[model samples]
Target: MKRKLLFGERMLLGDGTEPFNAVIPFRLHGIFKEEEIRYALGRLQEKHPWLKALIQYDEQHIPWFQVPEATVSIPIRLVNRENEDDWQEESKQEWHSTFDYQTKPLIRFVWIKGEVVSDMLFVFHHCLCDGGSAMALLYEFLKVLDNPNAEIGLENPILGIEDVVPAHILQSGKKQFKAKTIGRLAALAIKCIPVGRKVIDRQTDYLIHWKFDKKTSEQLISYCKSRGITVNTFLGATVLEAFRKVRGAAAFNKVSCPVDIRRFAPQIKDDHIFAFGLMIVMSLNQKLNFMDNLRLMQTEVERKTAKLNPYITMMVMESAHDALKNFTRLLKRGKSSNDCMFSNLGRIQIPDQYRTFSLETVFSPSVIGPLGNTTTMVTSTFRGQMDFSFMGSEGYLPQAEALAIRDEIIGRIRQQLDYKTAS
Candidate 1:
């Protein structure tokens, strides 16, 4: 059970020493034993083969995911719970913690142990999976933690590019030619693009987390619904507007949003440990009113999403393997172009209660890589409340400025809801 890492995976792996980690933190409101957690993690690894796999490099230095002859236990770190906010600090610690990729699996569990309430954090190397995959694993973990004998089925792992791109698309000579041409052009552009000789400092990373109560969350959702715009687009507009107002002329007026690849490629299941994503860059029209601007942005989002071709995109990326390093350099040193990357996971579907422990809540996931810009906003609704995790570094965005942007977002949403109430 071994396969070479895909292009996107290699980019994220980044020499295998630097950490590109994602953390999913959730609270459980019942007593849980360490053995129970170990049992549950074992079951999770059984369901997803990649969860137990380790990275190995061949003579040529290309990395591959290989299941060891003997099964490896998923690493678990236990911490005494001091307060409710301990998980956030622990998450920051995990962000900078690099995985021993060659020897161990690219995932770990941190248990903030308490008598009645325990906070569990699942941290993963971004190269192994995306946020959607993490959420699916979280659902399964809770299910199995309650009942170790839970009959969760096994995963049929995606081995190579052939598994994702259909036979017809892979064999199409014309499409192949098109993809190769685009790949060459892109590589050329990256080579020509002027980037700084050194990477940005991005000093002292930080995370800001907050949640709206059920009533306020519902009202915000209702406002977006009444305006006939998606919560994602509305949020994107809100983020861009906030950055513009706070940064003034310093704002880039652009936001990059990651569209889940599973949405377009049926071959990639919700539980597949895959990390490839398609992104669309959006900005607001400065001249239009807020509602009108949201409508336009929504239209643009629809258009871009409709035009996305995962098959071709994957094919093109695969053809550009030789340019991976250069592409990575551009990402690390290129002048910042976007205000931030914003992602809305929408509503979480996992049940909040089990037979034993009642799930307290799920925090919006946070990710920070060594990439040039670390500013990002992630929002998700869990249990009738919308949660947000805003991450940034002092060098890329001052903590004070980030706080101002956060307030602006909350204020803008409230102002819109208030206007609706008055009308």
Candidate 2:
């Protein structure tokens, strides 16, 4: 079976040139056989049909997910475990490597083999899945790897716009007319607006990862709870403050946070391999204090989230398909107004102990898109420790500044927690 790509998916596919990939890297403790890992992936492929499908373009130049009769397995690349930082280096390389979507599966695995401890990187074309979907896949992979008899179960995914939006809505003449009118106006505006002609070279992309111990992580959670806010809201405020401190007050205070559409779209299960992104931009109020700024940001988050109509957004984007190239051009123009993209996956729910192997740590998933600004910070917690992976290119943000920003974010969070405790 085959289905046409959604507008979001097509944007991720780009012009089939640069690699737009998402990677989830984690460390495992115990002896794991290569054959067992391979077998686990095979089982996963059987459960998730998209893992075996390839992207094929039709004559109209639109992409489609085509499942072939022959079974296809996700390719795994094994590398000798050198040191703790090997995954980071490999992740940087993966960012530049383009996928041959027609020949191979959109997803691939890289195993850094070690005797006692090993690190594995699950890389996927951003068009195939989001971080949430990737995490679900990771959970199943570990489950089957520990016990080959384990049942991961199959997922019934909503394949197209027809599934997401009701037939009545799509077929409504009034709705269609409004959607087309808005789409054409937006497309015209996009064409009329002049963007930068020069492209900023993204040189030397780097990844910085660090984790806070159980004590600090717990304190952070307590602090957020006491403040009547979430960890995501607090982190958003902290990220904005860090940029202001490092990049000057004149720097943009905006941070784009991707909201998991599964919360709103029940048809898209957690196990479904889908790439549609729903995002809300949060900006700090420079006039207010840190705590005040955080509260305001949280309020805005609540309001924006409550008002987010996924169906309408999906419909509008699909209608604006003709203007996708202009949207891509705007992104590639290297004139982003946002400071960075901050994604907090919250506490990872995957089990730590398997019958055969134990999950030592789950590093935050990192992804760098070909879009101009590559400054992104991804956070997740596993086994009571909060882990972070900060990825950026020197062209967008200098390496030294990126390190300073990372330190500032951590320090700011700790400062808030410590101050609250002292009071």
User: Each model's number of backbone clashes?
Assistant: 0, 0
Given candidate 2, what's the lDDT at residue 80? 95
Candidate 1 local lDDT, 1-423, one digit each (tens): 999999999999999767899999999999988899999999989889899899999998888999998888999999999998999999999999999988889999999999999999999999999989999999999999988888879999999999999999999999999999999999999999999999989889999999999999999999888988999998899999999999999999999999999889999999898899999999999999888899999999999999999999999999999999999999999999999999999999999989999998999999999978999999999999999999999999999999999999999999988999999
Q: What TM-score would candidate 1 get against the native?
A: 0.99
Tens digits of lDDT, candidate 2, 1-423? 788898889989997788999989999999988899999999988988888888898998888999888977788899999899999988887888889889888999999988999999999999999998999999999999999999889877657898877778788888888778877888898788788887778888999999999999999999989889999999988998899999995479899999999899887888888888789999988789988987888899999999887777788889998899998888888377888999999989999998878999999999998877999999999999999999999988999999999999888888888898899
Which of the numbered candidates is closest to the native, going by highest TM-score? 1
Q: Give the whole-model CA lDDT for all candidates, comma-separated.
A: 0.94, 0.89
- The numbered model that scores best in lDDT is 1
Error of 2 at 88 (Å): 0.8
Model 1 sits at a Cα RMSD from the real structure of: 0.7
